[model samples]
Target: MAQNKNALIRYKTIDKCLQNRYRKWTLENLIEACSEALYEYEGRDVNVSKRSIQLDIQMMRSDKLGYNAPIVVYGKKYYRYDDESYSITNIPLTQNDMDILSETVQMLKQFKDFSLFSELIGIIQRLEDKVYTEKNHRDSIIHLDKNEDLKGLEHLDVLYQAILKKLCLRIHYQSFKAKSPSYITLHPYILKEFNNRWFVVGRKKQKRTNTHLGIGQNFKHSVEP
Candidate 1:
């Protein structure tokens, strides 16, 4: 099934909120939590409706999305997961989930334009590897060039989003030629992969530099916008 990105975010936020058994979560609390989470991740304030969060909780309680979360109401107003160990992240993929993932991987592979899909290539490959491992019960057959110990990969998703949203980012980076790490404000434009390595192409936010920097995917990097 095709997923709604915002809905997924709301579900995750609700799940996280409910996981904190120490806090007594009400409907208003959940709505606030979801709104705050969306603002933090997307860098914008989104008005999360009560009905939307209600539906999110309903869906999480059902088997439709394979969550079947053990969410229960207590004291007639507060919500919490009955099973403390229950978490959506911990749920194993069902056979149907694997089938859908396999189809998605196959469909994505048909697109040959790597430039447009550079950042997604790693994520798709990881999904492909998981599907392959589950099916064959062994290691992946189709090996892609990836460094298991590669640093700064965690910044990929946030940077990609920032580029799409045209958000300026404050980055701390260290180049091999530099004596120490330097800090710069950047307007990220593209994520490029070449020669089995990834790079983020962007211009300096403060100075109008004609020559934009290509930040290589490596050690010691931080992004904040």
Candidate 2:
């Protein structure tokens, strides 16, 4: 794992170097950048080998990792991408990847009848739908549920992630009875849907009682701690 991480860091550094059209990139420059990057991440001076970087460039320039980066050398000394806009991180999804995502999402959705998995189905559906839309360049085909007038649906993904990651959130919300919105630090626990409406259940900071709030006009939030 350590070796893999270091190689990943070196590859990123090399890609960054090739992306800078303003600078004349050399092999030594890339090696130095990789060494610096690893040192910053590892908190120690790491010795980046010339051979390793050479192999990394070779690997990036090949189709083995699906990058097939257009690394070119002009003046026989400087290296840059032939296509300046290409990067390994932005590779388009392949057919196999799409198949795997479809299968996995469908499998998970099959268990949504169980209470433990009900609230998260919407989140997973959005993820799959997003991937599909990006891949197909059209609207999502797998429509799960339609609640067009639903409030706070835009914040569902972040709230769900916060609950799963055990993080706190500071949300600004105005209830039906309140005259103005107020901020509260929340430790999100569960998301529940009833009657086509969503509620977030959690405990507020410095409070013992658990509270459930209707998803309202909560447009801004921050982590409590």
Candidate 3:
């Protein structure tokens, strides 16, 4: 895993260790806890360095990450939170944090149609709601420089949804080369884009028809099916 990603895990691990008031956590104990936590995530042993943990503690104690954790070393040996109720999880989002998360949510919305991002829809929605209240007063952080007049882009989402639902599409399309448009009832398996152009790759609905079709949606249809 990346170092930046691992740092988050270590921070959480250290926070958890300090939260357990029953355990007198030493430096070594904190390091071991972080390593074990990483092992569970990475499925391989991650040697958590003492310096890294020290830096993590320092970062948490600082306002840089918006986590001014009350970490204090007691008895000149063991570590604990100065405040009993303090945990990094309880830290409120700073304005800067909200801005970054707001920008991220907007960026993620553009790719929400992909299967990989399907599970993130709920998370994205929640993040959007969170950042919108703060961001509503200001201009959006991200804006697509897309040409709204692009052909077939409007139908892209409808076809993409059909692909996910395993539903067939009956579309009337007229390619640029042909004088008149043609219609095809297809089982659209995928929608691919190349060179700023979109194509639907699917097979004919008629059985024993070995010919498959790769068509674009630029063609106009006579009827809505």
Q: Provide the lowest-lDDT 10-residue window in model 2.
A: 139-148
Q: What is the lDDT of candidate 2?
A: 0.80
Clashing pairs in 2: none
Model 1: residues >4 Å from true position, as ranges?
1-4, 41-44, 103-120, 132-225
Q: Where is model 2 more than 4 Å wrong at Cα?
A: 108-130, 138-225
Pairs of colliding residues, candidate 3: 173-219, 174-219
Summarize candidate 3's per-residue lDDT along 84-194 as a digit string, tens digits: 999987665668889899789789878867886755654564465456545455332222233223335445546655655567667776766678867777776655544
RMSD to truth, every model: 13.7, 12.8, 13.7
Model 2 agreement with the true structure over 37-101: per-residue lDDT tens digits: 99999999999888998899999999988999999989998999999898887677787888888
> Residue 146 in candidate 1 has what lDDT?
56
Better of 1 and 2 by lDDT: 2
Tell me the tens digit of each residue's lDDT in model 1 across 1-225: 223877898898888888888889999999998888888877988888989988898899999988999889999999999999899977766698899999998898676366656556567756866776676676433333454433345565566557656787777777777788777777776665545555677778666663234445533344564
Candidate 1 lDDT score relative to the true structure: 0.73
N/CA/C clash count, model 3: 2
